[model samples]
Target: MKKLFFAFMLCTATLSYAAEGTDTTSVMLGKNKVVIHNDSLGISVSIFDSEGHQWKKTREVNFVDGQEVEQVFVFSPFIPLRKNTKRTFYPHFPDFYYGANLLNANSNVVMRDTKSSEWGFSPCQIGLSLNKQNTLGLVSSLQFGFVHNHFNTSSVIKRVEEETCMLPLEEKDVTTSFLKYYYVKLPIMVEWQKRLGRRKIFAGGGLALEYRYKEVSKYRIDKQKHTVSRDLGINALGINAEAYVGFGSVNLYAHYALTPLFKKGINAMPFGVGIGITM
Candidate 1:
């Protein structure tokens, strides 16, 4: 209701100003200028960008024989009038972030509230613009991530025949123990972007296919370092759901694993939340 009233008042003011002989009234809508023009024939409306380029224009309305007559002389801004010379492919840039890696304890009864940390970097990202305005597009990226999981109690994952389970570590002198892994991911997403003056806002959501390429268990016992490399019953391929939103170059991003981390006998779903910067 308030918006309608404001529009009514603005239209009344524009008509009043237009009646004062070959005059125009202008208003700023964001960085664009909207101008209402009046002449001997009729009244017309036009919109211009901050750089004084005409963005859009509306038809004129003339008063003839005491009745309103509309004139049609408008061009759509979306229609391409010139040849295309812009590049079709461009770099999507990359994001670097660190966050906590959480496991769903309800699915895995043996594991307690395990504290974990993860960090990643996307060194390569390629994009293809789907529209001429570059507002919508598709992006594909390659990211590498490292995760470290710390157990509060003395525990270690041990293989029992065909199954794997976490058992108490026998080494009483063990001061610290943790499991770490590195993984590579490939993600593809559909993204949308909008420009507002000098700043731009963007949002995207997509799916990522990841593989845990390496894993290791480390322990410091009595000032001595020990390491073990094994399969650990972890799945090789993981599917994830990911999304991001941001203003300008900085963005908040999240990734949730859609599949279990372990192949059998245990259920652990991993997820990460962090901030990302373009480039």
Candidate 2:
């Protein structure tokens, strides 16, 4: 009986020594065992239930050589907790956007005998814009819009009949004569935008190309209606310089024409200031 009791105590001591042998430990995930071992530099992780699944990641110093080395390892489920760096990602859409602008156009005809400037409100400057993402805080856009301008000239008209033979039969002084010009303009610009709280501010400038397609003139002399339509042999193609500043989805812009309104006789430089909206 004394020999049997001594043998039982020795077996219990052996089992306790085996259970508390080393710092190497294991956890069970279902039927798989994930083993972890702490080293002098870092930790070694292994999966005993899966074949060939083991890796080691060193910290600031190497365990065996005691030299400084970078922490390198493949991404896995056993990564250490680290402070993540912050980053910002902006969303971009490669689609077309429709917008409109209400412009007060100041149009002037450049001629030797006439110094006429017309200021009118053009309400329907509508178009589409395509936007592309460039770099941070920068974006490129291609925009085109249909624009209209009206010019009113108050001048005199001399009437001569066939019987009068080059002599003026009557003189009509016209007031409030209307001249309308229609154009389709294209503007290419790069915008720099910044975010402040919930609002965004943007400022940009670009070149504009305008093509005039139609011109019409109408007036009333002595209570009688008279309309005259003629192709103002003006330069159909015009170039403009533009700049703008705005907040949110609204912007105020200014444009100055670098080319003449008419090809010959009239050297008109057109300019305007307007407000636009983007959706």
Candidate 3:
């Protein structure tokens, strides 16, 4: 009986020593409850809440004579994963931005006895930044504007009016003539961007389709005005390439069309430099 009592006491002491070697604690983090367990080999963290229990992570740190050799963390899934608090307020995913563009537009076509200058503006541009990495995005815009071409030859002006058949200019009655081409343009592009010290630079190329709805020629002779409107049957499709550098909410950009502005005679390519404002 004494030997049996001695064996039972030894077993109880062994169990106590094993239990004393490990430590455990429970902590409340926000709405979640977390349990931390530290043993000879490692430390483990487990989370429990209304969602039930889940094991988060286990970290191994060596120990020498009951002293831990390194520090470790018990992370909770409910907490944010960012290591830098300064970056916690920044957006970490895709977002949308709206902007406007103002461009000085011109064409590559060389018209005889004509000097041309054109400008375009777009008040609506909707874009999406695909990631917080700010590397890729998409932009789509609608532009409504006009192109003004001044002609020095009355023969050229009369030719345009006679071809459209809507307006005919008398060859002897016209002194000065100019043509206005009104257009509605739509462009969609995929872009890549890089942020550089308060400035962001981007480059992209895409398809731009334009509709020239009305072409009007204005002729002046003897201080009298005459106007003729016609459907110019201009080709409305084009491809464009663009690049931009931005600072804060403002951007300066350049654009070049890869295709001609019109399908037939006088193959004119459109190119422009512009400014944009973002919100």
Model 2: residue 40 alpha-carbon error in angstroms:
48
Which segments of candidate 3 are over 4 A away from where they belong?
1-115, 130-132, 153-176, 196-199, 236-246, 256-263, 274-279
lDDT of each residue in 42-114, candidate 2, tens digit only: 4344443322244333332222343444565566433323311122222121122222222222233211123
Quality of model 2 by C-alpha lDDT: 0.46
Question: Candidate 2, residue 158: CA error in Å?
Answer: 14
Candidate ordering by lDDT (highest first): 1, 3, 2
Which of the predicted structures, 1 or 3, would earn the higher TM-score when compared with the native? 1
| Higher-lDDT candidate of 2 and 3 | 3
Candidate 1 residue 218 C-alpha distance from true site, Å: 2.7
Cα lDDT of model 3 by residue, 189-278, tens digit: 776766677555556556666666566667678788676444454555556665555555565665666776544444455555545555
Question: lDDT tens digits, residues 105-159, model 1?
Answer: 4433333324578888888887788888778788889999898876544766545
Model 1 global lDDT (CA atoms, 0 to 1): 0.69
List TM-score per model, in order.
0.62, 0.45, 0.47
Sorted by TM-score, highest first, which candidate order results? 1, 3, 2
Instruction: Give the C-alpha miss distance for residue 158 in model 1, angstroms.
Output: 2.9
In model 2, residue pairs whose N, Cα or C atoms come closer than 3 Å (at least 3 residues apart or on different chains), thus clashing, are: 234-262, 234-263, 235-262, 235-263
